[model samples]
Target: MISYEWRGHFENPEVNALHAEGFDHAPLADDWWGQVTRHSLGWVTARRDDTLIGFVNVAWDGAIHAFVLDTLVTTAERSRGVGRHLVATAVDAARAAGCEWLHVDFDDHLEPFYFDNCGFQPTNAGLIALGTSAPRHV
Candidate 1:
């Protein structure tokens, strides 16, 4: 069984490592990730005993809108409703914080997961490429 919490303590390395496995982002120094999670409106984590398994962050503009960022669930834990639970927790937190809108941006591959599983409605969105896909190799 997995448990969720609105936690304040987020240790890097553990988190960066979990994120690397979950999100496929190259893991490096976690100083930046620590700073961001520390300042987020809310952060949710999933744990089984002492192991860090999943995480997500909620960012608000100090108004009626809140965005869900970095929704991650380890590959081993995927397709087991863990992602949906994380999103639901964030949504409830946002509403409790007086937010009227819960916004999320995800890839097309996740459309069914977020929309069908998590109950998010379809909407037109945009994306931009900010850097080269294949940086010059050495």
Candidate 2:
């Protein structure tokens, strides 16, 4: 059985592994715990038994707007409504916290999941990639 938690306890390595698998990349030593606790409105975790199978970070503008980031589900757990549940949990938590708007950005392939499944409306947005390399100090 799968269980979900909001602001739940999680280890960096487990989340890192899940992310690597989901995003198809190598695991980096990301400080997920520290980052979320410090910068996010909250986060959701999906687990099967004791294994971390999914995660999503809810970041906010420190007031009325929240953004979804790093939504991930383990490859084996995909297409099982786990991702939708995670976003639903996030939506409820953000609403309870008094956030007026929740935003998410995703690739074209995720339009149906975000719009149809999660009920997010389409919106005009912009982005500017600052190059792959780390930014240099002025």
Candidate 3:
């Protein structure tokens, strides 16, 4: 059985491994504990038998707006509702904290998962690549 928790205690390596597996990248030892503690409104963790299987970070603008970042589930755990549960748990936590807006940005391929499955509506949004050349006026 998978158990979900908001702001749950986690060790960096387990989360790092899960993230690496989910995102299909080599694991980097990121300071997840410090990052979440310092910047997140909260985070949700999904565990099965005490092993970290999923995670999602909720970052807020210190008030009404919350952004969902780095939603991840182990590759072995995907397609089984673990990712959905993680995001759902994060959404509830944000709403309970009085956040009025929840935002998420994802690649084009993930639209169905974010929209059809998770109930996110389409919205006009903008992004600029950091450390890259700025856009030139026509």
Among the numbered candidates, top lDDT falls to 2
Candidate 1: where is the Cα deviation over 4 Å? Answer: 132-138
Residues 1-138, candidate 3, lDDT per residue (tens digit)?
989999999999988997888778999999999999999999999999899989999999999999999999887788998888888888899999999999999989889889988888999999876555877555
After superposition, candidate 3 runs with Cα above 4 Å error: 132-138
C-alpha TM-scores of all predictions: 0.85, 0.94, 0.93
lDDT of 1: 0.81
Model 2 residue 84 CA deviation (Å) reads 0.2
lDDT of 3: 0.91
lDDT of each: 0.81, 0.95, 0.91
Q: How many clashes would you count in candidate 2?
A: 0
Candidate 3 RMSD computed on C-alpha atoms after optimal superposition onto the true structure: 1.9
- Residue pairs with clashing backbones, model 1: none
Order of quality (TM-score): 2, 3, 1
Local accuracy of candidate 1 as per-residue lDDT tens digits, 1-138: 788887535578877887788767798667735666556678788887777778888888888988888898888888998889989998888888899988899877998988899998977777665578845544
What shift in Å separates residue 95 of candidate 2 from its native position after superposition? Answer: 0.3
Local error of candidate 1 at residue 65 (angstroms): 1.1
